[model samples]
Target: MPLKTVNVGLIQQACGADRNTNLAESINGIRELAEHGAELIVLPELHAHSYFCQLEDPTSFNLAEPIPGPTTDALGAIARELGVVIVASVFERRAAGLYHNTAVVLERDGHIAGTYRKMHIPDHPGYYEKYHFTPGDLGFTPIDTSVGRLGVLASWDQWFPEAARLMALAGADLLLYPTAIGWNPDDEEEERQRQWEAWIIAQRAHAIANGIPVVVCNRVGSEDDPSGQTPGISFWGTSFIVGPQGEWLGTASAEEPATLVAEVDLSRSEEVRQAWPYLRDRRIDAYAGLLKRYLDR
Candidate 1:
């Protein structure tokens, strides 16, 4: 079969308190990438505002909005104008007290393609997402678009191999992560480096295991904590694109705002999977243990 290539772009941006400014920066990045022939563009997680999950105040919930609300309206307009598929993350306000970390996909014609709420919610010192977002109800499913089937997941979801595997089994062509992960400012340099390396390795391992390309977009720069109890988080922005063979196609800077476009050959996954054949030899019957929390004797 012939090569099925899609030019993918990732925007690595630093958000501030001003939502307008942050959204404008994302829009500029999208326009720039579209001009350079990017058919599909992805933004970082919660790109519209600062990382406000640092505190568990009820006021922070005001930042959440409906899915077809303002942010998507603006991004959809751009996607329609440029005729490119755009994957964006949003803090979805489902109801009065229900919220979710949702990843929204816009088709080329400016329509809502699909959405994937982040299933895994992390609660740590600097990153306190569980306090803000409810667990995602949508199962591991891929959003269909003109380019291909995109398995879009949020920051915490990237760490789970089961999530990636389920998406691959459901006919996903590429696994995309809209991430907002970073290091604690108080941690030692060595520890920080280990964390960063582990993050990258885990995602790349998912690619190698599933025989699908992995695209991740992360934020850059530091955002202060509201309570001032801790130093704050310094988002290490090493956004990257890797092939089905876990080979780096392109990578952005570790501490700067960047726009990267890489041509992903969708057809290559078939060849890689055929040679590796990891999926073919799987023992599905014995995998019931995975469903349980743990194998306690």
Candidate 2:
């Protein structure tokens, strides 16, 4: 195959309580990258509003909107005008009393390419997602676009190797993660460092294991816990793009908002996979143990 290079952009920024301001910032970031010749752009998870999952309030459900609702309409227009494919995350109100953390992909022509509902929902202190999102029913499927096939996943999904492998098996050219992760304000500095390093290492491992490039866009800055029980979360923004061999292509700032554009040679995945041959060596016939909750003797 011929070398197919694509300019991919990552938008990492902080979100405030104001919806319009957040949306505008994301749009501006997209436009900036588009002007710099990026054909594919990705934004941080839930760029339309603050990380409301910090504390689960029933009123937070109000933030959820339909797939073709206002957010898509707005992003679609920019995609059309800029002629860029966009991967954006949304708080999806699938139905009355049913919602999901979803990722929406817009083609360069401003049409809804495809959508992925988040399969993994994290439930823990400082990241109470189960209270707001229903686990995705839409399995691991990649969205096809002009640039290439995109394997889109949300925040928590990045931690699971199964998710990445499934997408790769389905023929994804590149893996994209729109994330909103941060540190609990009370943790020690060493603990925070370990957490951040683990996050980076895990994602890089996915690229090495699957022989596909990986892109991650994460939110930056601090968001206070609405209930005031805890100091709140300090979002560590280290958005990055890595090649098929798990080599860093480009990385953004850890403490500030950043816009990054990196040229990815899509054909490299084929070359790397041919050399690594990890997929060819899979023991699919003996992996029934993966389906069980635990293997009790």
TM-score of 2: 0.99
Best by lDDT: 1
Runs in model 2 deviating more than 4 A are none
Per residue, candidate 2 scores C-alpha lDDT tens digits across 172-274 of: 9999999999898799999999999999999999999999999999999999999999899999999999999999999999999999999999999989999
Residue-level lDDT of model 1, residues 1-297, one tens digit each, is 899999999999999999999999999999999999999999999999999998788998999999899999999999999999999999999999999999999999999999999999999887788999999999999999999999998899999999999999999999999999998899999999999999999999999999999999999999999899999899999999999999999999999999999999999999999999999999998999999999999
State the displacement of the C-alpha of residue 136, model 1, in Å, after optimal TM-score superposition. 0.5
**Count of steric clashes across candidates, in order:** 0, 0
**lDDT of model 2 at residue 240?**
98
lDDT per model vs. reference: 0.96, 0.95
> What lDDT is obtained when candidate 2 is compared to the true structure?
0.95
Q: Which RMSD values do the candidates have, in order?
A: 0.6, 0.6
Clashing pairs in 2: none
